[model samples]
Target chain A: AQSVSQHNHHVILSEAASLELGCNYSYGGTVNLFWYVQYPGQHLQLLLKYFSGDPLVKGIKGFEAEFIKSKFSFNLRKPSVQWSDTAEYFCAVANSGYSTLTFGKGTMLLVSP
Target chain B: DVKVTQSSRYLVKRTGEKVFLECVQDMDHENMFWYRQDPGLGLRLIYFSYDVKMKEKGDIPEGYSVSREKKERFSLILESASTNQTSMYLCASSLFVRTGRFGQPQHFGDGTRLSIL
Candidate 1:
């Protein structure tokens, strides 16, 4: 079955530190990928999405994710973390004809001030 | 701005009781979905509707049913609530098209944290 996997369950980083969250999926065909973030007491918000075209996609709040088809990976990264960046991040994949997404376990990113 | 609204922010109910969770989207989106967000489990889709009166079972739709009588509203129903069903429920909506913007990015509600005792 098609599924998404987020390798990091929780990560802690000091302010200004570079951050990377790993995500991988098991699917044989073309797919759409997405990254969503949920801050404390807030709803899930889209960070970035990759449907087609270039493998590198940039999203809101200076976050970006690169889709590597060979590795079945779509990893999220940020050059420098801020205290406000602390939140839970999720990686999701969608089947070609499906509107619903299959999400990974999610990574809780804690950016210490 | 597009908005998805869930009826309740938090709810508590007794086991075996019938429960209704309502979601409304103002964007006139073609697709509406219900998902449960649990710690360590991410978001698992429960049900989704593509059009009025049409519904499809998602990955984990065993304990839930959905209603989409109107274009803007989607309701998730639990025939009999169970403790194992306690989790945060989220509502989302997206538009459907073909080509360039084939699919609208999904917009999510704040979510309803349901606790069954």
Candidate 2:
């Protein structure tokens, strides 16, 4: 069984502020990581994913995430965030040879204009 | 773009009633998933179907069952709805890659917010 942990429960930021959300997973085997964002009154959309190879992956809307294997972490980062970036971010992890993904408690990010 | 459409955006039902949530995908994806989203819990997988007439129990499947009679339709059924089952239910679909772990970037539906009173 695998579990995902999102360090922050809620985050508030001003427009153009830098954003970083910590995510860690507990799994010993090969794992796939993903970041999904859910905007208000919208469906969950894939922000980015890490399958293998390069650790840093870029996603839509200038969002990026780094997969640190040693730390079992995949953190989402953005140099400058806008009001539109306000959404609930979820970190999900799926182990190799499995068909299910485990999601964290999610972090609610509110960006003030 | 792939489109996963859930039948109802908001549903209200009473306890002990049978509930069914419908989902349809236009991409003809081989994999379909049903999940429940709560306030703190991001999303918990309740069921998954890889192919027609093939279903698998996910992390939390004690009270939920899934049906996949066709390639594009997946239904989540609650035998006896309970108050705890009141949450936002999401449907997702993705192509099945033989070489991949599960699937890439699953396309999600707008979700159905069910309230069991």
Candidate 3:
């Protein structure tokens, strides 16, 4: 079984501040990684995903994540965050041949204007 | 846009009563999933249906069951509701792709916030 962990439980940032949310997974085998965001009063939506490719993957809203296989990490990064970027972020991992996703305790981001 | 619609946005059920949460997807997706979201817990998969009549138990499925009589619909059933079951239920649909980026994103419904009294 694969387990994901988001170290930051809550993060507060001012508008235009750079953001980085750390995510780590405990899985030795080949795995698929995903970053999902849940805006206020909205359901979970995929921010980005990494299957097998270059380590760095860019997602919507100018968000990007790097998959570091050696560190067992896939951290999400954004150079500048807007107030609308405030949301709950979750990291998920799914092993090959397994369609079900295992998510970590989400990190709540509050961006102040 | 692919739409996944849940039956209700808010529901109140009494303990020991049978409760059903319904989900319908417009896209012809082969996979449908039921998950419960709680504070700090993120989303826990309750049940998932790959095809019609083919249901699979997820991480936490001891007290939950799912029905998929049709490919476009999946229903979550709580045989006897409990206070612990009070949480936000979400339904999502996805296509079968190895890379997981073949089809559109996993569309989600607004969600059903169920309160067991």
Candidate closest to the true structure, highest DockQ: 2
Best by TM-score: 2
Checking candidate 2 for backbone clashes, the offending pairs are: none
What is the C-alpha lDDT profile of model 1 across B1-117, one tens digit per residue?
999999999999999999999999999898999999999988988998889999999889998998999999999999999999999999999887554333447899999999999
What ordering of candidates by lDDT runs from best to worst? Answer: 2, 1, 3
Give me the candidate number with maximum lDDT.
2
How far out, in Å, is residue B20 in model 3?
0.7
TM-score of 3: 0.95
Q: Write the per-residue lDDT of candidate 2 for residues A1-113, one digit (tens) a residue.
A: 78899999999999999999999998866888899999999999999999999999999999999999999999999999999999999999877777677889999999999
Q: Cα lDDT of model 3 overall?
A: 0.90
Q: Candidate 1 — which residues are off by over 4 angstroms?
A: B98-104
Tens-place lDDT digits, model 3, residues A1-104: 78899999999999999999999999867788889999999988899998788999999999999999999999999999999999999988877776677889
Higher-DockQ candidate of 1 and 2? 2
The TM-scores of all predictions, comma-separated, are 0.96, 0.97, 0.95
lDDT of each: 0.92, 0.92, 0.90
* Number of the candidate with higher lDDT, 2 or 3: 2
Q: Which 10-residue window in model 3 chain A sums to the lowest lDDT?
A: A93-102
